[model samples]
Target: MTNYDEVPYPDFIHPATHPGNMAAIARLHGVNAPPPESCRVLELACGPGGNLISLATLLPSSHFEGVDFAAGHVKTGNAMIGKLGLTNIQLHHAKIEDWVTHPESEQDRFDYIIAHGVYSWVPEEVRQSILAICQMRLSANGIALISYNTYPGWHQRQMARDMMRYHADGIEDPHKRLRHGKALLSSVAQNVPQGSAYRVALEEELKALDQANEAYISHEQFEDTNRPCYFHEFAAEAGAQCLQVIAEADWGDSTYEQVRPDVASALASLPKIRRGQTLDFFRRRTFRQTLVCHESVAVSEQLQSADMASMHFVTSSSLQGDQITGSNGLSGTVEDPTTRQAMECLVAEYPASMSYQELCEVVETEEPRSLATLQTDLFNLVCVGLVSVSASPTEVRREVSSHPRALPLAREQVLRGDTVTNLRHQPIRLDDTTAHLIRCCDGETDHAGLVERMVAYSMANGGLVEGDQVVTGEESLRVLVTAKMTSNLQRLAAMALLVG
Candidate 1:
């Protein structure tokens, strides 16, 4: 089995912030003031606390207890809980299967059991043990989420893994292994035809990755246990305990698009088997964090899709602050341009939020239904960071940056440079001319003083300032500074990075 035991788990972004979880939660339970404070969420192999912490932040009342054998990760998570001041979460430095199944244990049955990144990592015995615990500890109507590496998708990844293994065989150093793997791929490009499907796809993926910033890539690839799963196989394993798939994380992604049209169509044609097969087919699924439930309880014959867009948005693992629509959060048909446009507008103002009522108004839909109409739009808006949910009307915030990923890398650049001193991670990428403009944010510098400095900087450079500046005149310059400063402030507030 390739001995993945030694591989360190990927340093994944916490699941609380995971789009998959956010999407799944929205699907499982709406912002609909959950069932009860007594409901317990049990997570297995909850590495380093990102997922649990994020969920804790979202639902302050729920009791979340997670277990992992990786003590170091538990310690790191404990530190984050202290930093974040989350009170409802508890971390245990033991494997969950051991803890739950141990004799003399006093803990009650759990209402929700989430085991993401588990089934594929541990050996089959450990997985079965975990399943047995879920069956024993889960309450009626309880949900036990067990995410594994699904098949079809696993095929491509294994091909990539084969390449990696072939390139780095017998290489003990992790750095050397990584470099060797990447270098070997680069080497093969020279011999391969440029336009071939594999060649073209690999090149484009590499280029897109190169364009991605350091934090983004590090968060993505440099993990310990990034493995794949087989769909039907994992479901069959879970079924041992009467646990079944209720839905997937980013549930809509589990829709027609991720699956082949014919496959989806064929599944749609069948009844229980097709539904069960679709639930089982996580093989092709790249990253899954599903929401599972008891075989008898949560699967209702009602067949009500509460809100796909909203559920997907909050559960989505993507932190780009992009908006989503339909199925997951609030439901709407994208075939309707008003619905699409409404979602675009909401996402267009991320970190800054839009009211459900206001969104419907913007889409030009009629009154009463407008609120209902905007529901899905707002749900989708949650995915991309275009909108945030908050308590009060005045507390809402917004940002106008077109390229969000560039912001972090750009802020680092601004901080390192001597010209933009006393600034600590603000600008969403300021050009040299605009760089001079952002210093005005310190509150000491007035708008006129900023404009004068911007002009002086522009004059020094040839028509454009340093690092891809455009010469559209002072009016444009003022607009750029004002717009970015406003956007940065809003984003900072959303992240609690700013005061006042």
Candidate 2:
């Protein structure tokens, strides 16, 4: 096992791991669980604490504690917490086994436990320990999220991992190992004759690896312990620990509509758990983020419209005339007048969420529709990844301050040139101008001040229109700067970057 201190995993947010999202899914399945607003959260193997930090910032009432063996990650994460002035979250440098023995006193049990990227890559003892922590330390009606590599899907990826590991053996330096691994893959991908299945597989694997970060390759593929198991086997292990899987972190995977009709019919014959296992085989799923609760907790296998109606819905889609299109690569057009009207209303309040009842009221159909129909429409939108359902309502600060206050975590990330993770847990890559504008949103400048600073920064850094027509008049430049600032602020609000 490689010490993560050498090559730490990149700090990123996983929305599926968010307690609100997880709890919402659990509730939809008829499991009584704690609300995310003020729950206790525990994260195993929290590297640099980016995911937890994002959650803590958004849900200030919730308390978060992270435990990791790597001291460097803990230190860096703690430093970030201090800089952000957030006291609700803390990171400790300790092994999972050690932490379980002497848990924090503020909360004896956590409402949610997250172990992302830790289950399939650790030793058997460590894996069992993680489950034990969830079983023993999880609060009554708590939900635990564990993500791992699944077999059939990982069966192909394993071959690639083995090849990379074999080529990088005896390499001590992480960077050198990564370089050697890439070169080895490239050599094999190029030498294999065309039209060969082996060549095709290698090329496909290479293409996927090309987009991954070096640290990911080093720790994920090159790590000593990488175990991929069948979905049933994982479920059995959880059952042994007195835990039962309630749902997958991804809602689409849990629904059969996403699968072909014939395949779905075939899977319908098996028991629910077995059906999931068989579906894995059909889909060749490589990874899974499974959500579990104590076996004593009763959970419904089916989702109800009432459950969805109780939740709030949000989407980043744009409506042009009667058509609603998603920016997140969600396919299909929404043209039904009722659905279209609801979607348009949601889009108008971008980055904010509307309750199902509110949506119905706003649409005010002449031929009043049942809650079931609205629920189905919203679920369809969610299935296409165009919309998200949340247990809590979104809090947006529409009033731009004298110096508008952006999210503190986002401000820090922008200054450090890292991708900004929004409240939705989606990463946004900002250009130089946008990044500067975000940094300026520290709540010190009013609208005029912001425009003035943006103009000065733009003029000093070679005005807004570069390599194109230049605005000669000072008055025109200021007006252009003001309009640009307003548009940028609106865009930021849409991106969920503004904080109340």
Candidate 3:
């Protein structure tokens, strides 16, 4: 009915939805979460199983199960799983409410329960059933990640949604409805007064909608049901189901720095739910990815450095003078000398994670400091979101091997589409040339062989070109291909695509 079979939701991996990262956050909050390496994971409404499949490939020992109402999505995902020859994961075509009847659901409990992008989009009954499943199927100390839209940030988006629905009223075709809705919004955004606050908000929404794919726009803007609620209300609902809100998946979102000092102090004086609600009001958060656990589990309110000793740290941030500039456009300053040295170690190990003990050993070689000081500095970095902490290190190779082999999932994805998931559970778009190059990296082809295959591929597809001009000589073309191969290999390794 929603045109999901026609244009399925884009296959993607949400980094925050990764169980290892969730476990890290859980442990930071003093929950003895099950280890992600060998834990059982379940995903509700896991359309095409993109996120779960990636996790299964990365952690071979772990078992994964997904339930989706769409038969096409389940078929596509299971086909990919079969192609990959993975024995650890399966995607079932079943409704979320009926998942309790599934054999996997009846036999074992899941350590991590993920229900991303389903809460606000589904009906009230389905939403309650999702929470009920989390309570029934979750193991003791297991964490459940549930993402949904929040207010009052959505208030502006709601106005835009009303406009879109008004313009596309009575349109039975989903694609037609989406197109007309976007056109009306675009016209309004351009004609509105330039300096008005409403105009700015409209323009922002328009920009985001324009960049999204058709499937995303169809579900997000034109869905029949898009209910958003306050954080406190959502917490109350979860509490009624014997679950408690532990922490936000994105650590920085819940921090006090989002608002002014006085506002934060006022918020701190309120009850926990009231504090979260008031903070959301101050920050105007549009969406939330919240982690919940059994109500009996003791969640620590204060974070200590010792909590991080068992974790691994990863970052794609560079040391620019005293600032740590992350690839995600967020930056933080490293004023302390010891912290600066520690950041350098992390920068050198981008695309690969370093264990706490390994980082301590490396950082202390030149700048010896108290272990407590180092842990405290790293903890501050985590709070600021410059560095990501995970329960286990991602096994992505940083260096380019002579016979480089990408993960089978990425290699398979490159053949099917322009996007592939990296070891970090993030998508990377591949160009035609890069895709051709990656197809040749089967762990049996050397650098010279890769260049030869790429040259042949380019010549067969479209003649080789240097800069804006086509190359004339075979020797020059080979040389160009060699240079391109070297650069692309390093780039691929940096993107965490190369596994060997």
What are the models' TM-scores? Answer: 0.62, 0.91, 0.94
The alpha-carbon deviation from the true structure for residue 242 of candidate 1, after best TM-score superposition, in angstroms, is 1.0
Best by lDDT: 3
Prediction 3 global C-alpha lDDT: 0.86
Candidate rank order under lDDT: 3, 2, 1
Taking all chains together, the TM-score of candidate 2 against the true structure is 0.91
Q: After superposing candidate 3 on the true structure, give the runs of residues whose Cα lies further than 4 Å from its correct spot.
A: 100-107, 365-369, 461-476
Give the alpha carbon lDDT tens digit for every residue of 162-201 in model 1. Answer: 6656777777765566667667666675568878878864
Clash pairs (backbone) in predicted model 2: 402-445, 402-446, 403-443, 403-445
Candidate 2 per-residue lDDT, tens place, 1-500, comes to 33788788888678899887898899988987898999999999999998999889889999999998888888889989999999999898888887555345537789999999999999999999999999988998999999999989888889888987898899888888878887888898799899798888888888888887767777888888999999999999999999999989997786575678888787877776898888887788999999999999998876655678788888878777766678765556766677878888898776888888899898786464644566788887776678888888887765555567888899998876658978777678889878888888887778888888788877777667735777645566689988777778878877888884
CA shift of 249, model 1, Å: 1.4
Winner of 1 and 3 under lDDT: 3
User: How many clashes does each candidate structure show, in the order listed?
Assistant: 57, 4, 0
lDDT of 3 by residue, 445-499 (tens): 9999998888787777666766789874557777889877878899999999998
